[model samples]
Target: MKKALTTIFCCILLISMLSIVEASSHRRDIYDYKGSSTGFAREKVNYSLFNAENFTGTRMDLTGNSSADSFIGKFFGTFFNWIIGSTSQSYLSFNGTDLDFNETFLNGTIDTRAIAVNATMKLYVDAQDIVFNDSLKSYTDAQDIVFNNSLKSYLDAQDITFNDSLKAYSDITFVNITGDTMTGDLIVPNLTATNNITITNNLDIGGNMTLGEKITFAFGEVIDNIVNGVIQITGDLLVTGNVNATKFFGTYNWTEDSPLLSFDDTTLSFDYAGLNSSYDSRYLNLTGTNANQNLNVSPFNITANEFFGDINATFVKIALGSGSPTIDQMQEYLDNTGSSGFFTGGIISDGGSGTIDITAGQGFIRTTADDNAPLLSFNWSAQTGVAVTDNTTQYVFVDDTGTISLNSNEFLEAQDNIILGLATDEDGTIESVFNLGVRLEESIGQAGRFIRRIHSVSRDVRRGGLVFGETGTRNITLTAGHLWWGRTEY
Candidate 1:
């Protein structure tokens, strides 16, 4: 009997242990396992075990809405809640502690209140609350916060801190700041750095500007009233304005050796009324005043209209006006460059019925040569006039109106033939008249020697020698070797 009782006690203990295992197994199934509701009767299963009130440990379900709630809502919520909640309640606690559900951690709707985090501060949100504190001096340990739309009021209130490696504020505006140095590209919708802004170093602007009428820089101020004004200069102050003034003047040194000023017009004018001027040996100066106005240069008390010079002390002065051109002075103007000199002096004319008077130097004539020596020299200083009128076929009227005179030392030489006519009784007939004054010479030695003399006149009718008949007779003396012949009718 004693052995049976002991065995009976052991069996009862085993059965109790088996019951506990079965209850724990069922609890594990409710907490860690998930299946189709169709597998078990809904009325027979316990549903309260999956609720937040009864679920005590980490639970993972693989099916149903409960599975989604567990993985997305519960798992991430619990994790972040614990982390943030442990600090204080200064931040909102998740579910009841100091944490909250961040929708970024999951892809579905979640009951953030159901998730809990340990925190110290109470989480409160006011619509009209000041988002930024201007008086907050230190940003060394500040936390980050994000806002929806613009932070205009925040930036206007206080200076913000950027602690990350990269930070960006797109489409932002800030107004009214008092700071000495700013490092970065400053983009403003319309900015005016006005009045007494001094920059010691380089200021690089990377854009263009459009101006209205004019821009002025004065009183040690550099003002850019246009948009995106950029002035890039390598050395000194570069100004883009209609009027620019330099206060403390200094000598400007240029790196480029050749400097040029170009104008895109056909004419340029300059008025140098009050400016002092000097010219260098290496520079050429050209000045023009008006459209048709001539340039006059007065140097060394010698006034001139135009002066052209070279490097070798050769100079030429030209007098330009409406009348004739005059050469005032020339230094080394013409040299021995295989050139020739020409001098013309004479007069000539064709004498006919009209009275033509050719003076000493007034005529249409020219003188030229091949070897730079005068070939033909003509001087029509004296006038010779001869007049002859045709009266008949064989007779002409000669009128010696002017005094026929010739130079004593200059003798006239006739190489061609000469003809003379006399009056006749027939209407168109001519006869030669002989006089005692007519004479001829045979040689140069007999220039004044008379070779022939007329004595008498006769006619012959039978031989037709005197067919017209001769009526005039004259006597003349003859030389010894000459013979006198006469004719008579048969």
Candidate 2:
């Protein structure tokens, strides 16, 4: 191995020296035209056994035969097999020469079966055509394409990919491309936009809709011709202009028994129960224009003038005689309106005034006594009908809670008349408490049985004024034989 390497080393040295000597001695003026080639280097040659002067061929040719046997004989065939020099049809002779094709490729084309360029050489195409009917390869710059030596392709015919740079579209359905204009329609199950969206044309939705905050129509009458529906707005729905509708209904359900409507605050319920049991209701209800309403809490009083009712069918036939109402007229009102007025059932408190001022449109009836000791009163202050004529006439008012009284403030000639009360024999317990009497007869009735409001007024008994007792008198008036003189207005 060592001798072989030494021989190789000597061969390479000789070749290098020969190349340097030939290059420096020739082609001294070869580079004057640098634009003629892409390479800047050239070489010249000198031959010992070569004679270009007598060579007859397109390139300098070696004679057909000779010299090889001589070389083999001289070197004992060691240089012979090593291929030093031999003159054959187109080869080197005893003196080695740089073989060149005498044909010029300038203004011409190269005709060859194949071309294997030297690795260090370059085939430049400078402003000229390099006809390649097939793919030209062996590029190493990494930008030029090449096939992988060991990679496996899923499809050999088509292998194309796009990075972020040249891709034109992303997630989309059918795209309407009209010369790059962005006007298109998007149909989706749901859509959300952070900014405002304006629909220039009609947008029809077939399903139910829900909105978070407020939905406003266009500014002026935009929601015109809108009909009412079951869905309602709980919050304040404001409309600045006049709202016309065929009908408007209140959100309450009124019944026949208690037809007047009221509402609960928290639960938002409509309360249609009766206010009390005193006044029986006769309800008449409906909704529309000219609707007559009779459902009322009976004694929602307007100060009455006179009230008339048939004694037999009292509530069935009546009249609200429009005028000023008084405590004297209250009995008439109760008879007509089916109310518990002063003369009959309810207690009538006249405040502290011994004579009740039935002039005002308001009064109170306090029934705070025991069940057996049901006492009624009529109190007053500065009233005109029942004059207060000192302690003597002060008997006009009630003193005991269970006793009948008629109180007055002054001393009179004892001529006060029956002003308010009438002859009412409510189980014969009533008595004329304002009367000034000389003869009287009646047993004090037991509690809850019979109480009397006795009228022993100072009057000419012979003239037969307001009187209340059975025609079969318990006490005969010494003044008159006439019995039951007063008109029984109750």
Worst 10-residue stretch by lDDT in candidate 1? 410-419
Q: How do the residues 238-269 of candidate 1 rate in per-residue lDDT, one tens digit apiece?
A: 54576455532335433333323222243323
Candidate 2 per-residue lDDT, tens place, 1-490, comes to 9999999999999999999877665523322223446753233332233211231222221233334223312342332233443333243234332234323442233333123343223444322224431224324334243445323343332333322211234224443333323345546688777667776455767677665434445653222222455334443456769978886554533233434454443234324355334433333323233323443433443232553333222223334445844323444444333311123222232333333323221122234422222223333333333433333324332222223334343231121111222221122232224222211122123211232233234322344444444546475433324533232222
Query: What TM-score would every model get versus the actual structure?
Result: 0.19, 0.20
The residue ranges of model 2 lying beyond 4 angstroms of the native Cα positions read 1-185, 208-325, 328-490
Clash count list over all predictions: 21, 33
